[model samples]
Target: MVCIRCKMVLKDELTKLGLHYTVVELGEVEVVENISVQQHDQLKAGLLKWGLELMDDKKSVLIQKIKNVIVELVHYSEEPLTINFSEFLSSKLNHDYTYLSNLFSEVQGITIEKFIITHKIERVKELLVYNELNLTQIAALLHYSSVAHLSTQFKKTTGLTPSHFKQLKEKRRSMLDDV
Candidate 1:
């Protein structure tokens, strides 16, 4: 689960199944009691119907957590991050940066840095479409050193300059999950 709506769906499903949850945040859910296999299967099936998966594998769950963090940072954060991203992720996940990076790459077939870049670019697209902020503000908001650097990254990722993308009649933006 990467978004609030996903959490809501999970909460509704769990409630319908009569499972009390202590919390449902991002990629995790804390149920109040142990459930039977049938209940687990039922929950899984219900989640699947809503286009969500009940993750059981530890590695997959870790990957989801990583994705959730990125999504939250890119899409929801109000200010630019102050510290290094790897350090932040390492501290948040309680693992070494190198180990987390390696596991993320091994499971997701992409480096964590690459994933961050992708999501950041997607966020830039979203901001561009909204037309609420200009390139300079966007660059600063996203923690880029300068607008030129943001422009370079935007062009490299999308094959169009940010201004060009904004002027186009049809702008194609990826959903957060697709990213």
Candidate 2:
């Protein structure tokens, strides 16, 4: 549930159930009102039908929140981030960057920074597929130091230079929902 469609489903379900949500993110949703045990079970069952789960454990919930922050930063926001990914994530989640990194790596089997890079690269691929933004613009928008850096990292991650990736007709870009 890292994509817009997933968020929409969660939001729509909450509305249908007359439950107001403060947030609907990957692996978790925060409802505004307290619900009965039966209602909670019903909501969880309903979400399961969409292949979504209601996250419990505090650590898991925090992890999902962190992932949601990154996803929101990369895929949803129109404005560029003012800080680096580590600082931004730590600040947003109110946790030390080191602790967050350790927790994320331990649970997800990948570092938080690597997860961000993967999402950023996926965003770049989407922009490339659209052929709308030039490399320079894309690099700037994604906060890469330079187009060269973006190209270098992009090539390293996908095994193809951005230019080559742009020219290919097939779908090289991945779906964010798959994340």
Candidate 3:
């Protein structure tokens, strides 16, 4: 589950199944008892209705952890990234940077760098819409070297400068919960 409401849906489904889960964190859930095959099947079916997958592999597990980390950092955190993103990801996932980068590129068909950039741009779009923070503030919050850097990167990614992106105020911001 990627959002609080998604967690709520999972919780409701678990309750309907009479299952007692101790924790329902992003990327995982902990149940108090072993579920029978029949119960598992039913629970899986219910979860499927909400478009949630029950992942059960080491690599997919790691991928989800990586996504969760990126999602949290970009969409949820308010502070600028403290260090280089590669180092931040390496420490968070407890894996070497090269391994994580290779695994992510192999599985997702895109480098983790691209994924982070897309998420950052999406966050910039949201911030731009709010209009509470100026261009300089957005650049600082997202850890761009300066407003010029953020503008240049934004233009490269979206084919429009930050001011142009902001001018299209009617455009919808990508939802973090979906990504």
Every model's TM-score: 0.92, 0.82, 0.86
**Tens-place lDDT digits, model 3, residues 1-179:** 67998899889988998999999988888999998898788888998998988787889988988888898888888787668888998998799999999999999999998998999899998998889999998887877888988888899999988888776664444444355
Instruction: Report the number of the highest-lDDT candidate.
Output: 1
Task: Work out how many backbone clashes candidate 3 has.
Answer: 0
Who is ahead in TM-score, 1 or 3? 1
Clashing pairs in model 1?
none
- For model 3, give the 10-residue run with minimal summed lDDT: 170-179
Clashes of 1: 0
lDDT at 20, model 2? 91
Q: State the C-alpha lDDT per candidate.
A: 0.90, 0.84, 0.86
Poorly placed runs, candidate 3 (over 4 Å): 170-179
Ranking by lDDT: 1, 3, 2
Model 2 residue 108 lDDT score: 100
How many backbone clashes are present in model 2?
Answer: 0
Report how far residue 148 has shifted in candidate 2, in Å: 1.1
